[model samples]
Target: MSMADLVRAGAPELPEGYFYRVRSTNIRSLKVEIREQRRFRSRLVADTWVFERPDESAEESIVKACDRAFKGWQEADAVRASYLAVTAYLGDHDPKGGR
Candidate 1:
C-alpha cells in the first residue's frame, strides 16, 4: 500500500523530521525502520522488533515502530539536555536542527 494509505490505516503519526521505512526481509518477514532526519541524512532512531521474530502484522509493526521512535526522541532530548547546554555554551546553538 502507498504511504498515505498506510498512514490512513491506523499508522502512527510522524512528527516533523521523522519518518519510517517498511521493508520485507523475506516472504515471511517484514521490517520497519524509524528514523530522524538530520542535515545531510537521516539516522536510525529506533525500531519495533529489532532482532526478534516478526509476529505482529505489518501495519501494527509500523505503528509500534513510530511510537518507539517518537519516545526515543523525547528520551534523547531529556538525556542529552546537559550535553546540549554545554555545546550551546560553547557557541553551537543549533544541533540536530532542534528536532
Candidate 2:
C-alpha cells in the first residue's frame, strides 16, 4: 500500500471542515475550512508540514510531520531527540532510498 493510503487509514476522523493532503515528498498540506472553533475563531486556517530539507516532497513531508507530531506529543521534554528519531526513521524507511 502507498504511504498516502497508510496515512489516511491511520488518521483520526477530523471534523467537517478539516482536510489533509500528502503531496510529493515533503509537503504535507493541511486545510481547515471551518468557520470557527472555540479559541480559533477564524474563518479558515491553512497549515503546512515542512521538513528540514527543502528538496523533500509531499510524502516525505507527511512522514516527517507525523513523526514529529507523534514524538513531540509523546515526549514533550525530549523534542530534539524525538525530532532526530523521526528523521532517522524516515531516512531508513524512505521507499526511494534517497533517490
Candidate 3:
C-alpha cells in the first residue's frame, strides 16, 4: 500500500466528546469549564466551549457543567435524559444564570 493509503487504513474514526477544566479557588470552592469536540480541518479540537460556570463542589460542579453542556454536546442523549430527570425532580425550581 502507498503511504497515504496506509495512513488512511490506520486512521480510526474519531467520536465527538466533551473536554473539561477545573480550577481551585480559595480553599472551599472551585470552577469548572467544559468544551465539546469539533473538527478543524482533519483534526478534532475541544478547546472552545459553551458552558463556563463557577463550581463550589466537584460533584455539584460536574452536574452544573453537564447542565450547561447539554446544548454544546448535542450527541449526548444521556445528558438530555438526565436533565429531564433533574427538572422533574425539581419541579417549580428556577435557575438564574449568573453574571
Candidate 4:
C-alpha cells in the first residue's frame, strides 16, 4: 500500500500535531517514523520491520511494525515511557483548531 494510505488508516487515532510516515523502504523492509511536536520541543522515533512478501501483506507489515515499536517503547522503562506519555498526551488533545 502507499504511504498516504497507511497513514490515513493507521493514524486517525494519533494526535493532530503528531504524525507518522514511511521514512524509508526497500525490497525487504519498510521503515516507519512517528513524530511529535510540542510547544518547546519535538521528538521523533522510527521502527523498521522486515517482512516476507509471500507471508504478509502491506497492512500486516505495518501493524506488526507498529506493535513492535510500541512494545519496545513500553519495555525500555523510564526515558521511553516519558516520551510515550508525552506523545500519548499530544494524541489525546485536540489541535489548535478544532477537530
Best by lDDT: 1
Residue-level lDDT of model 1, residues 1-99, one tens digit each, is: 655666786666777887777666755555677777999998887654423327776566566655665577678778789688767667445767754
Which stretches of model 2 miss by more than 4 angstroms? 1-4, 7-49, 77-99
Give the per-residue lDDT digits (tens) of candidate 3, residues 1-99. Answer: 222332244322223454454446565555444444557523222222223356454344444444444344444666778888888766454577433
Q: What is each predicted model's overall lDDT from 0 to 1?
A: 0.67, 0.46, 0.43, 0.59
What tens digits encode model 2's per-residue C-alpha lDDT throughout 14-98?
Answer: 3454334433443443421212244554443333344545787655555556554444433653776778887865535666766
- Which residue segments of model 4 deviate by more than 4 Å? 1-17, 25-28, 38-42, 77-99
RMSD over all Cα atoms, model 3: 16.5
Clashes of each: 0, 12, 0, 1
Q: What is the TM-score of each candidate against the true structure?
A: 0.50, 0.30, 0.25, 0.48
Residue 41 displacement in candidate 4 (angstroms): 8.7
Q: Candidate 4 on 53-79: residue-level lDDT in tens?
A: 667876767766665665554466567
Error of model 2, residue 59, in angstroms: 0.6
Off by over 4 Å in 1: 24-29, 37-41, 50-56, 86-99
